[model samples]
Target: MNHEISNQLKQNQDIRENLKFLAENFSGKIVFSTSFGIEDQVITDVIFSQKLSAVEVFTLDTGRLFQETYATWDKTQIQYGQKISAYYPNNKKIEGFINENGINPFYESVNLRKQCCHIRKVEPLQRALKDVKIWITGLRAEHSPNRNELEILQWDEQYELYKYNPLLHWTTEEVKDYVTKKGVPYNVLHDQGFVSIGCAPCTRALKEGEDFRAGRWWWEDTSKKECGLHS
Candidate 1:
């Protein structure tokens, strides 16, 4: 382990011990958001196997998700036998936006993309998190350059809750190995070169030798790629 990381974690203690401590500290009313990706599956397994109580598991149904993603969600529910709650954008809000800007406003500009994401993800995510004290996610430090400096445990000022990333320091290979070894369900698009899966209209498989995140919002500036769902 990097001595710096070891010391940092030692301050909170390592992830394993810290998780138990946090779970006990905030025993009820915590939530974990899953996108049916590999990282999320791994985190889900951890939360379930550890028997964390009152942990609400939820997902955003953008209404434009890939067939593979939806299929994975079904498989995961059966495999885990857990009620993974689904959140959707309000029908009125979606219809109003679509009527005003047409069905695919994301193709026009980054701002519109953010707006769509806000309706489909951020708003619903906030609602799901309303009663939760801790927000668990499958975010990994290596997934994005901007996320490289994130700590395993930190307060999300935007959400005003403790954000936990159990796989913060895990590598892609490590995540894949874990999922494969444990037989966790994940988006099959990953096998076809999609490193990150999101709204169906906005995401695609990365080209050979391309950046891992190039497939997401490919039309926008790579530096400004996020839709603010995870930002």
Candidate 2:
């Protein structure tokens, strides 16, 4: 972490104040990626409702997202009147992979699944972060044990930029309360058992007492399930 900037961020009284500081100082170099989850919706509300245009907001469309996710996307744009940018995987690469290994080979093995994630989410994210200095994500430590090791603001050597997890310390209850009070639009799947939603085929609503990430890649071993987007 850059202690100077990190200290400056800590000086802010709240997330909005910190975001405003960044907007005023690092305008045009910051970006936020959302998936319409409760946590992401909170960030979107602040960035859009507050009209913090300095931070570029976007999503990675894996082309396999649930219809409910799409509906939430539309409602968010309509309510906020801000067009969230979209990034898709490279056509040639996806098409070539599909032709060579069938459309859903990711179901066959972990290696295949990772390849799919790299092509669909990671690659597009790489393109999205090009020339970007700060990458914002609605990551909370409670989401997974892996995230428990991350700081709210830190340098990501993988992306060659600073990563900001504004809601890192926030609990699930706090995030839900923020969304409801702010009237931020969110995915309906959350009303069911879906604590974490992603691609349609890859994600499922959690059963009882399951880990946050179990909703995604439920077929894989419980060791660590990441899409390569976050580290």
Candidate 3:
């Protein structure tokens, strides 16, 4: 991490205050990527309700998202009166991929799934993050075992930017409590056991005691489930 960002991380303040500090100092250079999940909604509430003008908010619309996700997206806009930019996959690439492979090739193999994610997510994410300095996320340690090693603020060499996970230490219950108290717009699928929501085809409701990320790409090995956007 940069020494300046490290210093800011050492402040030990609440998420809202820390986010305010980052927004003030890194004005026009900060960006938040959301997927309309509960944790993302909490951060969206903080950014919009606090009027964090320095932050740019965007989402990758993979064209395979659930109808509920779109509804939550609209509700979020209505609540905050702010537009969250939507980034789409390149039409040419998508067409080529679908023509080369089947429309649902991801179910064939892990490599195919990763290829789908790369086209629909990673590529668009790169475009969304172009020239960004600080990338804020809704990542929580408990979301996945892989996320446990992540720091609250860390350097992302792939994007060449500082990544901030303001909700890094927050539990699932804490996220829900905060969202309820703040009246943050969230996806209703959460109440139906969809612990972590993603593109519709790749996600499903989890059974009891399953990991939060288990609902996403459940057919793959646990160690190989990331969509490459965060990795």
Candidate 3, pairs of clashing residues: none
Model 3 agreement with the true structure over 1-231: per-residue lDDT tens digits = 467767777566588888898898888889999999999999899899999978999999999999999999999999889999999999999999999999899998989899999999999999998888899999998888888899888889999999998898988889999988988889999999898899999999999888777888888875647899877
Model 2, residue 127: what's the lDDT?
A: 93
TM-scores of the candidates are: 0.90, 0.97, 0.96
Model 2 residue 112 distance off true place after TM-score fit, in angstroms: 0.5
56-80: candidate 2 lDDT, tens digit per residue: 9999999999999999999999998
lDDT of 3 at 117: 92
Off by over 4 Å in 2: 1-4, 11-13
Prediction RMSDs, each to the true structure: 3.7, 1.2, 1.3
For model 1, residues 18-122, the per-residue Cα lDDT tens digits are 555556666666788999888988878776666665577889998999999999999887887777899999889989999999999999988888899999888
Sliding window of 10 residues with minimal summed lDDT for model 2: 4-13
lDDT preference between candidates 1 and 2, better one? 2
RMSD of 1: 3.7
